[model samples]
Target: MEEREITIVKGKRSTPFSRGILAQTLSQAGAKPELAHRIASEVRAELLAEQRYTVEEEEVLARVRDKLIKKDALVVERLDKWRILRESTEPIVVLIGGATGVGTSTLAADVARRLNIQSVIGTDSIREVLRHAISPDLVPALHKSSYAIKPEDIRIPVKEENTTLYGFRIQASQVAVGVEAIVDRGLKEGTNLVIEGVHLVPEIILDRYRDHPNVCSLVVYLSDEAAHRSRFYIRALGTAMRRPAEEYIAHFGEIRQIHDYIVESARRMGVHTVENFSIENSSDAAVEIVANRVSGIAEKAARRPSSLLLDASARGG
Candidate 1:
């Protein structure tokens, strides 16, 4: 008893025993094997009472089947089933970019909600997070670089929920890094990602992963002249007026130029273009269009490579 770790079996006091010793005694007792198994199960349950284990039984089974197929442990039919299951489970990645005040953020939120994705990342949030890595003095300049309003003139609303504006400016490099982090995380977790911003596009964010099988990046340009002008005017009169008129005017042109550049670049890159302005009812129509296009893209991506390979093999044959 002194040399070995011992525990007193307190249940029913059938016999005084240690933990391991009790298990042996229970097995050897004149109890039916099934009864003894039940007793052992009960004892184990009691011992683990304070700990909690969440077992998703279906997910576990699927994973086990997948592993078997990967390892060639299953029959041909079962292996085919596992392969189909694995292909169907791969996730989708969507990047939505448009000019400012084009409802990109709002549309992204709606799409994410429709998809039941609770984790949503905006470009502004990513910018704020990367602010710490930027130089303090250079941050103000960086902020001004992308905007018509001077850093000093812009007074962000002082509210608990509006703290996303207080951080340092995010440079292009920083924005690219943040986008990659979010996109990579989403793909790895088998979850969908909606990245909305003016800067999200190829040669910046999506180009890095152009070859990835699970990634789908679409450039949505809101191209209604009247709506664009109206929104621009409203924004200009609201928070943008804090800056000098000349500075504000200068930024307006710059933003417009950037928007045109993005549209042209998207076309050149062959990214799917959705004309949000043409839709009769913008919000609802935008959501419907996004859902349809995204689903279609996902389906195409899942099948395109296989089809291409099959065609190539047929040609070779």
Candidate 2:
């Protein structure tokens, strides 16, 4: 008996070829057409359970047909007799940032979920980590440099478990090291980082990494005047999880001013901007924008020199 050789090609945002292969294999084993289809569906569902598809479900069936066409070409030409194969890997990085209440965190998470990539990292988490490793007094100073905290005699409760405790001690010189660590660990692991915060501007952090090939930095400013003000007021009134109303109310103006400055800085940096006023549709729109941008960056990187990887490797060195 001659063995039939098979080749598999996976498409971006498409169904698994293993399903069709299962159906064909079962049919070759003398199974009925209906039984083969049923068995293939079960097998495909099991295989697909381990992976997530960013593409729509309907597109998967079409993708399967495309894959089958390519397979047919290979079989017709008997190309298996001579092997010529190449594979390229390209990763994408999306740096999403904005003011405190601009829904940056939620947007990052939503984008990550849609892309099926875990690369989202909030800037607040970075700040919190830095604070944890530095002196509490230095936090106010660092915050001042980023213009995120206003000069005031008011004292803030420094949580020991928070990242900003020691972050105040982190110098601008040290920011590169922190960013490198995050990117190497996050992006290399196939997670798209959505680092958000007032300080995530190019002048502050990304300038050090602008030329890196693996990184496609995007600064998203979520603009919503009415909603922003309403959210700020809600925080000022003190939510169930936070401090008293008077405490937040006293600093409302200062916080709002800081956010405005951040938005202005982002605008000056020529960051890709998105006006996210409609909160209801913002998540889906954000996901689409981010995914499309990332896909573009990845496609470009595929054609670029491998030396680009060296740019990422040189970070913090």
Candidate 3:
């Protein structure tokens, strides 16, 4: 009559039944933690009533789906997505890129919080760090604002749009070295990070993580120039004490040029783009883009799995 007397048959072998696996599958399907546990508890009773020593893995899957169908019809797709999220062993890296005033900082913060990731870094912070380590005499671009960098240093002809693009790209390249280093370290440590900043351009990030299934890159932009300019106005009013937002306002044209350049590069390179017309829409789009990219942990851990197997000590939370 003891619990250990029951076994679940799985592909030519049987093991002591554990509801941990059931709860995990249900949780991945979008069941809340408490509900997942309650569902698993109820299902275990149903399985025992069969009065069999072993139940097929396929049968278990069927029962799990049935329970979900009764709970809510909409969760089927959510379940499929969660299944991949549950099974993937790799850390998730989300890189968000945008021009100075496109609101990516806010979007990235929300997405990171929603994803439950602990690391959120702004590339502007990276630029500030580089300024301390490198001298202006060595890297003049590092010392000047990307838009305000004197044309005397630029080798290219100073066409208005091209001039700004060229200047920003130079500063971006210098900052990119630090960004890539952080990414490399995170990959080795198996820690997830959400890095948001202007320097996370499609051109640079694509080179580093395009082939990496665990990393997703996104570029945010605003189609309406007037609205984009308004963002700078609102920002200036709030932080009037420290830095004058008017400088950004005065250089708005140059900022838009860089924004366009980045968007074009993202399109050419096939990096995902989210337009920040509204915060809710942009945030929802960003999360879905990431969820779509994460492969199932269960699928990858299925073959003689160690950590992902049905061990009660393993935390599915």
Candidate 4:
């Protein structure tokens, strides 16, 4: 027998319920993989058993919330926070940074997916574009790898800072101009974006937008040197040796030095830092951090007086 399709009514539109999408949403809201799928299956089964041909989206949400609240209240809270973020009209901007081999690109993609952000750019891409526009002689730092910066790469040096960090900083600052321009365009155009790269030293880009509720920034690092070293091999293998592990390994000391500098900067600036132990654990932490930041903004907006709220809304705050 052909099964009856369950339709979910949202506003004036209706569509068939999807267990996969529901489960993915649950997972994005901090549910475990197994638990999210199980909950999705259970919700579908319950709806079918009840013979509900058509149900409001609110009913579906209530059912899911009931299931999650009984199992994990925190997950339910995350669900609500995500809902607030999703419903907000403001553009969300996520900035992720890490030294080489720390998986910032991977985590940035994961976080962007979970947040339903459509635009993802890398600082490396920004640097590449800048390289074409400007000459290496004019900006020598832009031509070198962030981890393997030499004294010659930096045209000017900062007093007291080591040549390595100073060169990295100079390169990063040059790229920061492009990064900030992209960020400004995103904010003006109201586009959600996730930008990640080695050059996104939290202090440079993050500090400027730290007070903005819709903006979130964090750094990812691998604390264990062995694990950090092994990731280059794993990454190389995954890429079919397009990015050879040996080259990165040869400069591993310099890469690790840059890693330490970024981590130290993050700590000193009170920025969020996620240790890249495992993707699942780190993704969860990253999502939670975003939820916390956005939720605070939503909550503060809620508490504001109506007149003040209207004024803030008019000013696009």
Q: Scored by Cα lDDT, where does model 4 land?
A: 0.83
lDDT of 2 by residue, 139-176 (tens): 45543333223323115455433223123223332444
* C-alpha lDDT values of all predictions: 0.49, 0.46, 0.75, 0.83
Which structure is stronger by lDDT: 3 or 4? 4
Against the correct fold, how does model 4 do in TM-score? 0.91
Off by over 4 Å in 3: 1-87, 155-161, 237-241, 296-317
Better of 1 and 2 by lDDT: 1
Query: Clashes in each model (backbone N, CA, C under 3 Å)?
Result: 0, 22, 6, 0
Q: Ten residues in a row with the worst lDDT in model 2?
A: 78-87
Prediction 1 global C-alpha lDDT: 0.49
TM-score of 1: 0.50
Off by over 4 Å in 4: 156-161, 298-317
| lDDT, residue 259, model 2 | 56
Which lDDT tens digits does candidate 4 get at residues 184-262?
8998987889999999897777778878877888999999999999999899878776658999999898899899989
| Cα error of candidate 1 at position 55, Å | 29
Clashing pairs in 3: 84-296, 87-296, 87-297, 87-298, 88-296, 88-297
Clashing pairs in 1: none
